[model samples]
Target: MKKMIILFSALLVLSASGNQTKAEQKADVSNISSANINQTIEILSTSNADKSLVEKGVKHAANLWRASDGTEEEFTAFCKENFITDQAEKELVFEKISRNIEIITGHFNKITLDLLEPVHLNTFEQHPIDNAFGAYSVDSHWMNDFYQNKIAFIIALNFPAFSLGEKEANAKNWTRQEWAYARLGDYFTARVPAELLQEVGKMAANTDVYIMDYNIYVGHLTDAKGNRFFPEDKVLLSHWNLRDELKANYANKNDGLEKQKMIYQVMQRIISQEIPEKVINKGDVEWDPYTNMVYQNGKTIDATPEPNERYQQILNNFHANKAMDAYYTDQNTFIKRQYDGAKEISAEATEKIFTDFMRSEETVKVGKLIQKRLGRKLQPFDIWYDGFKARSGMDESKLDAQTRELYPNAAALEANLPNLLVKLGYDEERAQWLGDHIAVDPARGSGHAWGGAAKGQKAHLRTRIGAKGMDYKGYNIAVHEFGHNVEQTISLYDVDNFVMNGVPNTAFTEALAFIFQKRDMLLLGITDDSPQKDALKKLDLFWSAYEIMGVSVLDIRMWKWLYANPEADAAQLRDATMQIAKEVWNEFYAPVYGVKDQTILAIYSHMLNSPLYLSNYAFGNVIEFQLEEQLKGKSFPAEVDRIFKQGRLTPNQWMVEATGNDLSAQPLLKAAKEALEELK
Candidate 1:
């Protein structure tokens, strides 16, 4: 996941209104007063130039210039000295700034990659120096330096920053260069201290490390009857691997439901800080999650529960983020920065979309269908029921065997990228090019795709590959991450402007990942020609969306609670999180699942480490479904290249260009209703 602090500066100050809190009402940090703005504009308008353009340039420069930058005289002189009157001259300056920023940022990205190697990669055990290096942001000082050198002032003078509302309203008329200029304005809008950014990075890195190494020896888990359901030496990482393991058991005939129940219990213990500290990442003892007891050599032993370490990490992340909130005068809270700034969509809008979809009749319809398939009452853990997938009935062991043989290591998977792409409709040459641009690595945690910031630098795809080999679960995650690499490679190397080198937000890239994940079976040469396959796919998407939307709601509510209760301790935060999860579950999920007060929705690791990222998965499903509809009759690879090449337009604009429709849950919901009828 991208560091939240890196994108924290991309905010425009919102106007104060009645609904805002007192703290939020004070968000504006513009250095220029209304009188000063008028003075600067009048002085610049006297020059023989377009009065409108001169006024805009002067006001923009005034907004960014502080007393520390200069006195009012210097601000006026700076605007008069730097504002470009000629259109051709302005375009030339824009190009120069874009090219130079690309060069600077590219090198900075490379430097960070090298410095973070020991921390991110599994090359060696992390040392104290590694932690410090990983926390250090090479580009943290760039903003301060640019402002001090007057480069930032020059850009602000020429390319005025646009509010999120302004961009949404007028983006249709903007040229690509205009969009690039708007992005440039976003670069220095916030003046957070470099030291604060470094601290945020360090806190995030520490949390990442803590989560990455959090493993549970499933084989050491025993039930009340003293029977181990998992294989010997089977280790699963918290929450991702554990959850995936629970889903995988739907195909197991012997003790599938029981295994899932046990995993669910383990998740509860972890979320509540009831899991024993010594048993974590250690295979030396057996434990029963239900009784919260440990055993060695068939004898019960005492162990202390983990002392709120999980919640402490989350608190540390919050404090680090909270420290920088004051610097963001407009988008004061991290929620505002995430939504209005990074997501380019309002939190209220996102929450409405998620809740509307979850509460729709289509969700209820699909839940009934899942219940019918399972031939039993739904449990709280049924949120993860894997019955909708094509492989739900197949033997997971056989699939795992096939994957293990095909991908004996990360190198083997890397070598097969070309063939996988070819199967998805890329030509031999194009497939080779994409494969060349992506590097696969053995991940120490759940897999993630890290896109290259510069041309020619390979995007890293990191997934777990055990000593034995890559299993089906790892292979599946690798394919999903590969989609991110493809989008990253295309947007960076093929896009026309360096400023527009990525999608509008992480959600757009996540849409591509979901698309590739849906085609994992296709990549493995497994095809379904059944007429009901399309309907099943729609149902799968709908059901998965239903599940994650609740989790997203929990994430959103938890963050809001944290902000409201900033002085709350770890234990208090944990209690609040569980209560919020239960509230969300009761309101939107209980009716469908026939269960209430479920805390399963609160167990996502991203809640603790990444913060407010769960919404992207839900949004991604909506986009992926729309893109899938658009690609129905087109060449897969060709359509992918065409759509991703449009570059970082706003989410709505990007969706319109890619699918000829706006991003909406209605399309998926409509299809889901039709699928439910057809299936019935």
Candidate 2:
């Protein structure tokens, strides 16, 4: 599932202007000193309340107060006035805040979904006004409004914010209500300007539009010798469809290698901004990605390369995020916020996990096994080798024909949702309930699952469905997104706390999606009974983990470079990104592929739009492996319900509860090694 846009409810709430330095951005009036907090606690402590409760409430409120909020005296006054000392009253306050936030956030999410329909769904012809409305964030001023009403300060006063470190160390003892309170405390930690928040949302929407429309007329692509390989009517969106197309070609018997090489070249052109500007989303031109040449109506013409537009998108996101850094006193950089706040995993820990797996000897073995299976030396693009997949050996055309016939349109797939779930071991009633909660739609771009924020609101499963039918590739992606819908429904409707409505992060959802994706064939009534199936599954997962971990490292390094060179322009960023990709590839992938300095790692579209999200795929794979182990001899529906309903725990804690192990590559690595030995 694609990560949803950062909700306006989650925007920064600090008082600093965008231009202020980090030091200058510190809370002026709200910065309550330890002495002041102690004095306030003493003053507030009376026969009605315990000193500890007063201290917790005062300290928490003081920590959350901002200069723009009011004077120090006002902060004290607000805390004393709003703090709920009586146990029954405090419980009531917590319930009110939780219920109110759910209503507010849920409505805002629904509004955004409805407004973006033109852009996100293919229900109608999109207009300029649609894009404008899609980009407009309804919740942009929500934080500001809450602060103005003093509601933010009240919540902050009652529910103290917990650091990630504190959560990790202490949350094992926390009740569901306590966890909800901590999440409430998380609401007002930053004080970014509303306009800046709006700008960021607009920038993301613009980027989404760009990525969605970036389709390549695969049929129109020509070779240096003026030969076209793909079907005349076929179109592939970058880099999702393009990458999947390359994977699909593993079953092609004629010129498959050439097609893969051509696709790799096209990816390189995209990454380096060397692709002809006219070739993108346009079939009027036929181009050779290798020779950097274009032709129209059987005549060659000079064409300008895309003018670093790809890098500019990245730079725009960087600047928008950077502008708010001063307001995030605790997690200042976007990198910090993404890991510590959004991912709830430290950067150091995530990096260590990714690097450890990528550098493992098991990865080397897997690469060698893949090369042996291919009966050729490894190319950088072999990172996507699909030979291990059972579907790779089947004719893609036959599968496409089958899928197209079964799902002739979006409605066909939507109608079959319950059947799909039932095939995966869900009972008839449960499957119907899940299906009812998830609405399927034709996507304008590659498909994604947009989860609903409130109960009774349907989570949308969007996938590309052609006029003729949903093809095999689209079907595969749809099933994956369907998994997200399942998890979304369970996590939201069944969870004990409203604040904890999703998984720990996108990765956990991705893991469930993978589980669903791997069963697409079963859903289609196609079964693979090969004895080597289990081993192949392990090897495939291992290889995928290896490939994405390298890309994740490159993504991390690219962002780090951007932070270091804040003044760098698009062209400069492009150079740095390519260099970072190569460096990461050489260090990790080169030893296995025996190919050095490949820029293929930089070709993921998520790096440009999602920002540091590639790591989640690698993490998801590791978690999926652990979950797969736990699911052995277990009920699929029961396990899924039990696990997903554990909602929004820290990743490691969730892992331990679900799998009786921490998130680690070791399980996957060990399984892959054993699989390789069996295959040998």
Candidate 3:
């Protein structure tokens, strides 16, 4: 999820063109026959008697279409072939599938041909088959992004979870009935990617068309060309999956005033647990609570933590880091004192300085003047380091032309990257290996990530470099993204999980990337051991933690408000969220004046699109601080490289195993504040 971004950033403020009129084609659904009902039941009842034979038996038994190749034509054909025109017959058939457990269960088992994997904790059983279901009738990008890769991804989900010792299967679980439910219970989606209301309105309004039978629908989203728009990485999906995350995360005053930790605890508990059941209405009995953690079933969570000592430490570290972060916010009166530098400048002057930076030009007064305007937005880094100064040692004041003009993109400048990574921590071999992977291209949309040969388990990874209008800041961003691409390329391709890959969480990967990004100064051969350079490093940590931590707060508070008043409209929700961020800004950064428009922070689309993800930014920085503390002089490259190689464990688990300390915010905050105090 390093490429994690919302489809709605510009929609918030900067309205860029995204008016996609969905390829105005409607889809239809089907009717279940008695043969269909009986066949579905048989498949669910059976097991892996003959893997190959079962495939032949499946189609012979029921008229099921393999969405294995979910193309627009295939999807459309699926809809039309199965669609029932007679309302009475359609209801009768759908009722049979819905009412009979065996029918639904059998169908679910059959659909496993498309999804259902071993390590994956999700299974969107019966999806609403429509124009959106990977249809490539009019487009071919679907071949690369969807059909071939999409089906491969589905199969990837089937990759068996790597268990430690045990190897045998059939001897464990109880019944086929249990397996049927287990297969369907793990994953979820709201049927279609479109708004639930929109889908419902369409379904109800149009009786002529059937978008396939609703009874066998598995909730999955697809784009016009029929590609899964979701992030491909499973670990990233596990941490911040939009649909799955928000469904359980809801907790506002109206529904419940549960704290985030409590909610997070519930979420953690159910990692392998069954779904929690809540009463739909006063008359309804409690639906069904999730069973319990697979790692710990039928026992009290307090009974005994799982046997993984390393993971326990990770949990401990997570708490410690969060506790330390809390301490930094509450520690002293220094936080109350204003930066007189900011107060010295007027709002107009501050805006002018900021505008100059935004316009990609030189600014003599960025530190004081810009800080006042940006306020909490301004971490200590914005104080002195200019993007222009960062890349080109020549002063921004002296360089009259743009940064690209001064430092042209040439074979000469390409080496600046390898030299940069080596300075940070990479060895000669690793640096050259990574440097060679560097690649550049004009990007579509706004952001970029590791693409080309550099993405996922393919020995050759092209470190995809996307450049947005040439500027010093853009160049710096390109470098930062480059570090991320390198880390991702190396980790995904070089690490063990080529078949089962990617970091268990985006945070750990981000920490590695940030480690590279933070080296911008040191990487460029600027070795100022002075208080300013030291201050710059410390400032970078503080600023990194500050930005992400603030985002976490916003996410936490918004979710709080959202669940509190389930009835609130979008306007009410937006307004209340704005107020929450403003107050948090005032508290965390009251010292910095001219900090109007705190609500701008609320503009971060991640708050709406990516639930509970921002905290990782702060969390990653804290981990980096601790990792850096241990690796300061003692074989940092070796230590960090080994740590990055262990991909599958949770962040906390990884940290505990690598470093003695639990995930605590103190190391980063303490080290940073100490550096700040020294500067004073």
Candidate 4:
């Protein structure tokens, strides 16, 4: 039987929304100092070693790899040398987490330390020729999905116990979180095995070709609303569709394209219909089934604030459909544009570039040409991850001692925000207005911003800072992250339950945050309208949207595949995902590079950590493009800031205020088309 969704993952987050009083619990730990913090923990977690020792002897013993050039087996042996039995077992994943801490210790504790080197994370372009077991490699997207599924599974499995409280409830019904978890878990468990099969089929084909419809399973099944997912009794389902001129294995041009468009249209229309309902009833879901265990639903899904129910429902419905429909409707146009313009760089030219880059004497660097061949890299797939360290214009060691200097944690960001805003080009008045309106605080945990957890009110802004340290290399992320905090702070603080929080949906928030983030360069002593204004804005927008649109495509397809299968197992899910990934890359991505069946995009961690978040990046950039028009040359409009201060307003209304327009693909496509068309 299906279980309840408990939102345990949500509760696991000790957010300000949590019932516990954080102020009483959170002492000024910075006073203890990062040096003391690191040393104290080392003494506790590891001991009897020189704290400052560069190489491991005692303290570093727990996570140490062999001093010699050891193989993976030898490294494990070295780990056993010093770690307590319990600690040693965790060396695999824990060590990676510790790497973050190790760098922090190196800083003595300051987030402002310059620890990370810039990195290039274009894994999507790399996996084509990688000899590592083809698409079946766990290092591919499948691995990321596994962890994500694991989390959902745990939530589904545990929520029943949580809601029961061992006393009140039946102790064996689906709670809200458990129910949601089971729904998502059911999707993943079924998908994993299905995807595995798909991967085997691709590997068996032997030719480096893509099966575009692989992520999509062709099956006869009724959708949630009881409509047939495929018109035929048997569905020709897969994630990839030949949009615009995106070529696929299917030979029929007209019939295939028409059929593909119909599938896309139905999805677009279904989402247009279902999403509104889901959003309205989101907080409310019925639950009754008890399997190994069960929980009960508490909040009614789709319930809205009484004052704004009607308008908000309209807004909710609009927001639900707008982001996906934009792409779904205009997918053909994007494909056509790329198809007509994609340079026919043959397989020979492509491979030659890959070879030339590899054969170069320099081994420390990896460029896009070489990077595209390897699957699995950390994500956001941006330029922040550069091979070489960023230009170290400042001293790293001294920065660590100055917590008060580098946005001293999140709370300090709000405290020091006015000065930073001034430095970043905001006027004194506007800067002060920000300080007055928003409450900045450290993230209870992780990378997201919106609706505060405190006081059950949408009238407060919470700026969460989760940066381990604001190192020079990581400052870009810091600024971008703060942009999210700032937007989330403003939008939520200014509004009540009527408008409450959130724009259209998550995407609107992302776009707004991005608007602030793209200003990072400007804030970093280079004002947006400075000497390079024209070129700077163009470069930023082009790259930002260019990167996110491709991501959005993958995200949209993933959900569809999940919805279609409804019962795929882990291996099948893996194969199905890989096949879909290959197809999407080939159809949408390959032509541009004269490469086929590339699965580099599978490395996105969001594919595991947060479903559908990638789509928000694309939508956010589109919304940003439109908002940019309204914000142009305004010099920090107070009214604009006021609007932003109202957290979580619907995207369309925000657009109406910010740009006198509605949510449409026109702005996003216009920006993208204009930018790409002008590309050499």
Q: State TM-scores per candidate.
A: 0.95, 0.96, 0.45, 0.41
State the lDDT at 621 in candidate 3.
Answer: 76
Model 4 residue 625 lDDT score: 72
* Residue 497, model 1, lDDT: 82
Residue 363 alpha-carbon offset, candidate 3, angstroms: 27
How well is each residue in 1-680 modelled by candidate 2, as lDDT tens digits?
A: 65453222256311122332532444334566787777778777864876765676687677667677777777777766787778798888888887888888888888988888899887789788888888887877888788778898787777777789988996689888877777777787766667776676677788889999899998988897888899989999999998998998888888888889999999999999999899999998898998988988888898998999999988878877777776666898888888888788878888888898888898788888878878889888898998888888888889889999999988888899999888989899999999989888999989899888877788899999998899999999999999889998999899887877788878899999998998888988889899999999999999999889888888888999998998899999999999998899888989998888789998899876788888888888988899998998999999999999988788898999898888778989899989989998
Give me the displacement of residue 124 in model 1, in angstroms.
2.3
Quick one: RMSD of model 1?
3.5
lDDT per residue (tens digit) for residues 1-680 in model 4 = 00001111111110111111321232211122334334434543454433332122222221211223244443334333423324334234333432432232223211111110010011124343432333232212332243343332222222111111211232135343322222222112111222322233223222212221112222222233333323232222112121211112123323433333334433332222221222221222321111101111533234221242222222222222222212111121212211111111122332233223223322112223224522223222222222111111223324323432565465555566677677656788877766565444332112233333222221122222323433332344445555655555454445442223324345555665666556554554543334534433544554445445555566556555654653444444455655776776565444344456555455343443234445556556667777777777776545456656543323444466566787655554444434433532
Best by lDDT: 2
Model 4 residue 259 CA deviation (Å) reads 43
Misplaced by over 4 Å in model 4 are: 1-414, 423-430, 436-446, 453-468, 496-499, 527-536, 645-650, 672-680
Ranking by TM-score: 2, 1, 3, 4
TM-score of candidate 1 versus the correct structure, residues matched by position: 0.95
Q: 269 in model 1: Cα distance from truth in Å?
A: 0.5
lDDT of 1 by residue, 556-617 (tens): 88889888997889999989988998999999988888878888888889987787788888
